[model samples]
Target: MKLTLRTVGVFTLCLLLTACSLPRGAGIEQEITAGANDADADFAMYPVTRDFLPTLAEWPVVGEPELNWITASAGARTQIINPGDVVAITIWDSNDNSLLAAPGQRAVNLEEMRVAANGTIFMPYIGDTRISGLTPQAARARLQSELEAIVPSAQVQLAMAAGMHSSVDLVGGVNAPGTYPMPDQSYSVLSLISQGGGVSGALRNPQIRLMRHGQLYGTSIARLYSEPHLDTRLVGGDRVIVEEDRRYFLSLGAAGIQDQHAFPQDVVTALDAMSIIGGVSSSRADPEGILILREYPASALRTGQRGPRQERVVFTLDLTTSDGLFSARNFRIQSGDLVLATESPVSSVQTVFSLFGSAFGLVNAVTN
Candidate 1:
């Protein structure tokens, strides 16, 4: 092919267009903005309708005392009993002269016994007995009846010497992060978090989740703490993970201000995010060139990795439209998201000034 001015001009134009394209960081901003606008419009057109609505006139701001009392009392306690729990059993006889006249009374210490696969325990005098589903009091009654058959008029007592002990693991954004012993085992999620010394100062509403066999179990910390009944018991093999809060976006480049800001956990409108970045700088920020770029985990882009699959969806955002720009906040920020702001065309003025300074330096060097 023969080279010509027309072809050269076209090639130059293409290069200029490519250069004008936003940088990698700016792509994330555009994606977020677009997503926000789309979500906002969807929400506006179809305002959400719920099953019940509270009336301010009827309900007091502080709530009713009776209602509050009911709510507090309604919170049920959860018992987390497991195998390998150290339990003490006491036996007494009123008419049996042999047991009553014995010089010394000895207490049998059955240090925590592992729950057998069949869920039965073999005690000293009692043959294979099922105590898995029975409460401490019930188990004692059963033991007394069985022993009375052998020796009439026998009294029995059964109690847990020490509460159940289970290993609960804690990590991330905590002062003291490690496995904790949940002994007086109750279903209080907050109790477990307190043992771990709570979340770090930088994180807000830290996500404390309970997992078993790689599956999420139980509700969030907020819900579990507020509603005690929801604070499900921690099982023997259950794992508790405390993760750092990562639900915020970073706005950089030519925006009015450049900084990382947090978004609401539930739902954030695009207008909310724009306000956080100081509402865009008119002098240095490009109104037409706003972009949003999202990076995906490399493993996510690949096929068939072991464990859970990661979704790496990247999109764009244009702030030119009044409604579209305001919708940016509606797009939620996923963990590890990077948001960037693009500079206006006038930013090149600084480069020109730098070039002039370089030329002046060269002249001085040549003269010297």
Candidate 2:
């Protein structure tokens, strides 16, 4: 039968459409199921418990009451008052004639006195006197009374001269991690981080933990940034640990990009993460079918003999759909998520042709 130009064009179009519409094999479906099963198996290898889910739920929302530094029994501020502390005492209306005369003059110029290990300090003719446990003001008054007998109308003033009377240690993921001295005795956790040169550049959603007496008092980072009230005050010996950003997700298979990436804090969406690895490789990618394997914390799963349980959800999206849905690509990805892209038969066929062409070219070159 003779075919007209119009008929030939129509036939070709039909052929192309039919080829595109070819039914996918049960093998492909099985592969997807098997892939999911394998992923779950891999996940099952680790211990999974539901303990973490509840903990995540209990976490404070965007707005909540700020925690108090003093009330927080976990990271309480502890003051280590010890001997050998240098104390400054100011005496007015009292000449040093007596002090100079006794104890063989003792160098004459004494601005501060060091407490001996015995918890006593010798003041000229006053002899050994215990002054431990006395606040600077109280100690001054006691010294005045003792000196009054030798020097009439002697006024005394006492204050802490050295050592950490009030300070906090800033450690972990910060530019300068170390102990910072708090002279004013009143500074918030945020201030201490600033003093330690701020958070490290590589860390995202940097975690700040308050540890008091070797126990976890409170943890804040992302939540604290949202609510300023949560950044509680810093106390002496209070440990403020800022942990680095270690959470991440994996992307493998037929994706345009195949690699692992450090999870971003707030701004990272599911789509944004895909873009980081170079998006789906169009040549081998099935734009209609994509898979995401989200791995919740082991604590979020059910406890079993082998390990913790994992919950897997599969979703498919057509790229040809409205652009709005594509924007969902920005949906945030959780830690341990694995993104997989499948290959379309058409793309596979194209790859085979390309390989054949390359092989033919090599043979011709050799023969030539």
Candidate 3:
């Protein structure tokens, strides 16, 4: 009996000695950050707190494309003739010897007179008449005055059909994507989207992109919906594309759900990301060791207050403290960040204790 007890004690001591080598779902907080303090460490570590928030904000934004958006501007509601527009004209002359209309004909119909690149259309006797920038009503009056010189009783009627140069293209992420003719100068991004059909329901956090004369502009649909003042007017020959938000982040280790998650909205705080990732595993994760791993471009590293000290950075968060909780709520998660929920140190100790308890129970049974 004494020998058996000694054997069990020796076996128990062996486990405690090798406990550090025990298999674990994730690395303990200290294990991951062991070499972080070394002078030649490759990464920089920062504790996320209220005081650090301001400094972090000054760092350059990474992972997402930087884009600019145009503000909305008011424009005329009437359609103006463009260079590619097609105009139709009708002339009414009561004179029997009219230059425009034949003897028996009281009216002359001129169809499909396309506006030229120089904003002018050729008439039989009037030569090239500039009408590109004029409205249909104004162009008709101008043409009538010009025709009245040849036929004193002449009156002109004009109609315009928008051409390729006077239309905007709805590229994608819409129900009906195609070229839509701009009815007037007041045609807006929202109006164009409505004409093509609203953004696709399947798209997750749809984004708006405008391509105008080689320049690109971008924004999210949510913002445009909330701020009416940002619904900028669309110009002719512009190409607008609506697409799903491509920004995403990843989760690993003791997190509840370890996988890639798309950004739910424009901005995602650390608290928001934790919720998106289903929070950490309550049984295994250390609440004080939530770490965010991010890698910035080499150019983002600088010796100033406005950039990161290293290309690779690890931001630590302690959900166990009130300050940490509040800070995490404001810590914005950038695109491509990795949310790592490290394992608790006591978890492995508890595991070893469980094995020891089993061995002690077996010894009691043998004695009984």
Best by TM-score: 3
What lDDT score belongs to each candidate, Candidate 1 first?
0.51, 0.58, 0.90
User: Which tens-of-lDDT digit does each residue in 157-179 have in candidate 2?
Assistant: 66675344345788798889887
Q: In lDDT terms, how accurate is model 2?
A: 0.58
Could you give candidate 1's per-residue lDDT for residues 297-357 as a string of tens digits? 3443324332112233332345776545544544444433444466555654544455556
Tens digits of per-residue lDDT, candidate 3, 42-155, equal 999999999999998888889988889999999888998999889999887888988877779999899999999999999878989999888888898888888777677888
Where is model 2 more than 4 Å wrong at Cα? 1-30, 34-86, 90-152, 162-165, 172-175, 200-205, 217-226, 295-299, 302-332, 349-368
TM-scores across all candidates?
Answer: 0.57, 0.58, 0.96
Better of 2 and 3 by TM-score: 3
State the displacement of the C-alpha of residue 328, model 3, in Å, after optimal TM-score superposition.
Answer: 1.0
The segments of candidate 3 whose C-alpha lies over 4 angstroms from its true place after superposition are: 1-3
TM-score of 3: 0.96
The C-alpha local distance difference test score for the whole of candidate 3 amounts to 0.90
